[model samples]
Each structure stands twice: as C-alpha cells, then as structure tokens.
Target chain A: MPCKFCSEKPVIQLPNSERKLCKSCFIKYFERKAIRTINKYKLIEENDHVVIAVSGGKDSLSLLHLLKKYCQKRNNKIKLSVLQIDEGIKDYRDISIEDTKKFCKSFGIKLHIASYEKETGKTLDKIKKQHKKTIACSMCGVLRRYLLNKYSRKLKATKLATGHNLDDEAQSIIMNQFRHNIALSARLGPITGVKKDPRFIPRIKPFYFLTEKEVATYAYLHNLISKFNECPYCEESNRFFIRDMLNDVEAKYPGTKHSIVASFIEVLPLLKKKYKNQEINSCRLCKEPTSSEICSACKVKEKIKS
Target chain B: MPKIYLEKEDKILEVKELLVSDILKSLKINPTTVLITKNNELILDDVKLSKEDRISIIPVISGG
Candidate 1:
C-alpha cells in the first residue's frame, strides 16, 4: 500500500488513525504531532529553560532527541538541559547513567545528575533494605519526582519535560481510578500540577499523545542508545498489572488507549476546576510546596533515618 | 522473500509476505515487546509486508 499523504511506499499503519505513511512522512508526522501537542497545551514559551528528565531509557532519550530536533527545526529559542537521577541501584542505574552521559555529550546538552546517596544519604538499595514492607518502585518514584522538581527549581527552569507517553498516562489514569484516588486523577494530564508556583516547575510531556510502541520505534529508527534492561528491584506493582491489562485491551480493541487519554483530557478541566482551591503550603523541612507542614520526601527520610 | 532484521541480535530472517503479527508469531516473539520497522520506518501489526521490504525488529520494554 502507498502512503496516505504522499505517493511514496507506505511503511507504517497507525493503529488509531489507520493512516499509512512512508519513512520521511512518518517522521514528519510524529514530530508534528508532538509539536502540536506542545503548542495546543502551551507547554513551553519563548526563552523558556526546559529541563528534561532523562533516564537513558527509550522514552526519555526519545524526548530529549525530539525536543532538540524540534527546537533546531523551528528555531525555537528555548534552552534544553538534562536531569538524571541516580537511584544508586548497583548495576541498573550505573549503566544507564553512562548511556545518559554519552547521549548528552553527543547532543551537546548539559546534564545534571543527582544521586540519592548525596541528597538523602540513603540510596534506593538501602531504603529497600530497611523498609522491606515498602515497594522499591514506590520509594524510587517519590525520590525521583522530588529530586527532579527540586533540581529543576534550583536551576531556575521555567518548565520540566518528562518522557511520559500515552501508555503511561492512560495507565496512570486507570490506576488512579482503580485506587479510587480522585484527587490524584485530577493531577494527570500532558502538563502536570494544578496549582503552579514559582518554586515548583511544571512538567510537560511531549510524547503525551504518542504510545510506547511509537516512541520506541522512533528511538530505534533514530539509532538512539537506550538501555532496555528492567530494574532488578522493580516489583510487579499495580501499575504493572494496569499496563498489561491496558495493553491487552488495546490489542483487542484498537484505539482504546487513545480513547482513554481523550476522555481524561476532556474531563481534566473539570477535575482541575474542582481541585483548584486545594490549599498548598511550604514544607517545614525542605521549604518545597506541599499541602502539609512536612512533605512526603521528608517523611520518607525520617523513616530511613529512624 | 522479505527479510526481517533483528537489530539487537544482528540476525536476519527471510520469510514470505506476512502480516507483522504473523511474522512475530512465527518468530515466537511477543507482539507487545518489540517494534517492527520496514525500510527504517515503523510498521503496525496489521500492515502487510512484501518480499522486497527490508524490516527490522527491535526489542523494547516499558519503564517510567
């Protein structure tokens, strides 16, 4: 079959759109969709310092590559930097950090790496050892998010960009619904955080509309170096289950993932409106934005210390 | 015959025209865990491939 847009030989058939596209057309379509999402959401503005979170994984690396290409092609004045969090997982993080550094060096982007051992004095390995009841992913998730926001804010970044794609976003939405966390569900979107502050950098997802499959294909086609290894400490969290379940549903019913994200986007404004007035205060320990006197990171630190 | 190149393994398999899903099945690989590309472009599972096509299958797993 020929490409839907051009007469060139078709290469891909989009699951949702069912539009067949050739190599160059597919690349253009992918980049254009991402830029469209950014513009539609006003994710970034002129002269914005965008700090991207890179994990040396396909998604994040793809985000970094695409964002750089986007800026160059459009002559965007936005500055891009990379922030990598070393969770101190012995082999898993060490290898990826090296890959991240190499990619950053090749791209000529500045990279800032924050290790849990330095900031919290406890690596994820140690935390997992001490807190046997807690999941490694839970601990890593909180610390990674806290460090990303803290470092981005310290760098005076106007926005933080993450590698979250359609699959991740849809899984998060379904997981939140399963957990019955409406407030958290309110926080899910292309751009996160309902109440924004100067100290808190808003995160933008450039791959918000693309799926994991699409992002992986783009990364591979671009020959981006990414470690496909799963973390040794990663357990089957509810998210894993949700991810598998959603993938199954998507396979059985094409466009289900897109619909899930679309419905969430449609209702996001109302969710934000409903939760907009929630009070936020500074954490006494870190002085970061939090609803309570003490933040989740502080609480986790206390657990590790005690 | 169409040839599928496994990028990570640096191996290639020659096969007849087949749907991407069927090709994956013949290789005993899970469809969800890999990305199929033809002539350096992504190919969906439903897309049919011809003998002249050069395909690459790259294993991809999900993480945050």
Candidate 2:
C-alpha cells in the first residue's frame, strides 16, 4: 500500500489510527504525534529544564531524540539533560551504559549516572543475594524512582521525562485495576497526578500516546544505537505477564491498548477528584514525599543494611 | 539470498525469499519479542522478502 501522506510505499499501519505510512513519513508522523501530546498536556513550557530518565533502551533513546528534535524545530528554550541509574546488574546495565554514553555524546546532552550502590550502599546484585525474599524489580523500581527524582531536582530540572509509551501506560492501568489500587491508578497520566510539591519534580511522558511497536520502529528507523538486553533481574516480575497478555490482545485487536488508555483518560478527572484530598507525608529519614513516615526506598535501604 | 542481521547476536544469516514471519519461524525466533527491519525500515509479519533485501531482527527491551 502507498503511504497515505506520500507517494512512497507504506511500511507500517498505526494501530489506533490505522494510517499507513512509509519510512520517512512514519518517522515524521511519530514525532508530530509526540509533539501534539506534549502540547495537549502542556508537558513543557518556556525555559523549562527537562531531565530525561534514559535506560539506554529503545524507548528512551527514541524519546531523547524526539524531544531534541522538538526543541530544535520549535526553538523552545528548554535545556535537556539525561539521568541514568545504574542498577548494578552484571552484564546488563554495564553494556547499556556504553550505549547511553555514546548517544548522549552524539546528541551533545549532559548525562548524570547514579548508582544504587552510591545511593543506598548496595548494588542490585548484592541486594538480591542478601534479600532473597524481596522481589528484584520491586526493589530496583523504588530505588530507581527515588534516585531519578532526587537527581533531577539536584540538576535543577523543572520536569522529569520518561519514555513510557502507550503500551506501558495501558498495562499499568490494567495492572492497577487488577490489583484494585485506584489511588495508584489516579497517579497515571501524561503528567503525574500527584499534588505539586517542591521536593517532587513532576514526571512527564512525551510518548504517552505512541505504542511500544511505534517507539521501537521509530528507534530502528532513526538508526539509534540502543541496548535490547533484558535486565537479568526482571524476568520474575508480574509486569512481564501483563505485557505479554496485552500484546496478545493488541495483536488480535490492534487498538485495544489505545482504548485502555483512552478509557483511563475519560475517567481521570473523576479519579483525580476522588483522590484530591489524599494526604502526602514526608519520609522521616529522607524527607522525601511519601504516604508514610518512611518511604519505600528508605525501608528497602534498612532491609539491605540489616 | 537475503541477509538477516540479527541485532541481538550481532550475526547475519542468509535465507531465501519468504514472509517475514516464516523467516523468523525458520530461525526459531519469537516474532513478539523482536522486531524485523529491512534496509532500516520496519517490516510487518506478512510482508514478503526479496533476495535483494537486507533485514535486521532487533530485540524489544524496555523497563517497567
């Protein structure tokens, strides 16, 4: 089929829109859609310092490239920096760091690499060994999120951007629903649904509308060098199951993921209203925003130390 | 023969003209876990390959 936008042959058919596009046109369409999402959500503003949380993976590399393109094309005075957390997994993160460095250098963006060992005095490998009962992903996720927020704030970033695409968002929504965690579901959006606080940098997802397939295709089309290695510690997570199930459904019904996100968006205002008065406390140990006296990261740190 | 560049293994394979899915099946690779590209352009499963094409199979990886 010919590309709907150009004379070139179509290479892809977007799931939600079913619009067939060729290679170059697909790239343009992907970037333009991301820009629209950013504008629609007011994700960025003038002179905003945006810190991207990159994992040296396809989604993040594509996000960084697209955001850079957006800034250049629109002449937006936004400073972009990269923050990568080293989970200290053997062979996994070690290799990804090289891809991260190469991309950051090529893009001329500043990168700050933080490690779990530095932040919590224990690498994931050591933590997994010591705390055999603890889920690796659960521990890694809490620590990575804490470090990303802490470092982004330290770098004076006005906003923290992540590479979460439509698939991730949809899976998260379904996962939260399956777990019956409405409060957590309330926190999912283009921008975080949390109340504004000085200590917390608002997290934004520029690729919130694009599917994982689209993001991967974009990365490949751009010839971005990225590590496709799965983290050694991630195999046992429930998210893997959720991801595969969603992908299966999406394969049969192409726009199912989009519908999940769209349904969440429709009810988001109500969810926000329901959770608007929820109280947020500061962790007694780290003084970070949390729901209890001690934050998850601090709690994990205590476990690791013991 | 079309050359298939396996990005995960950093190796290339010579194969005959077939649907992208068949090529992956013959190689015992799961289509869901990896993406196929030809000349740097993504190729869907049903797409037919040609002898002149250079394909790349890239693994899909992301953090939750």
Q: Evaluated on chain B only, what is the TM-score of candidate 2?
A: 0.87
Off by over 4 Å in 2: B1-17, B21-33, B50-54
Model 1: what is its DockQ?
0.35
Question: Which residue pairs in model 1 clash with each other?
Answer: none
Whole-model lDDT per candidate? 0.83, 0.85
How well does candidate 2 match the true structure, expressed as C-alpha RMSD? 2.5
lDDT per residue for candidate 1 within A39-91, as digits (tens), equals 99999888999999999898999999999988887686999999999998888
Error of 1 at A153 (Å): 0.4
TM-scores for all candidates? 0.88, 0.91
Superposed Cα deviation of residue A173, candidate 1 (Å): 0.6
- Candidate 2 residue B13 Cα shift, in angstroms, is 8.0
Model 1's chain B yields a TM-score of 0.85
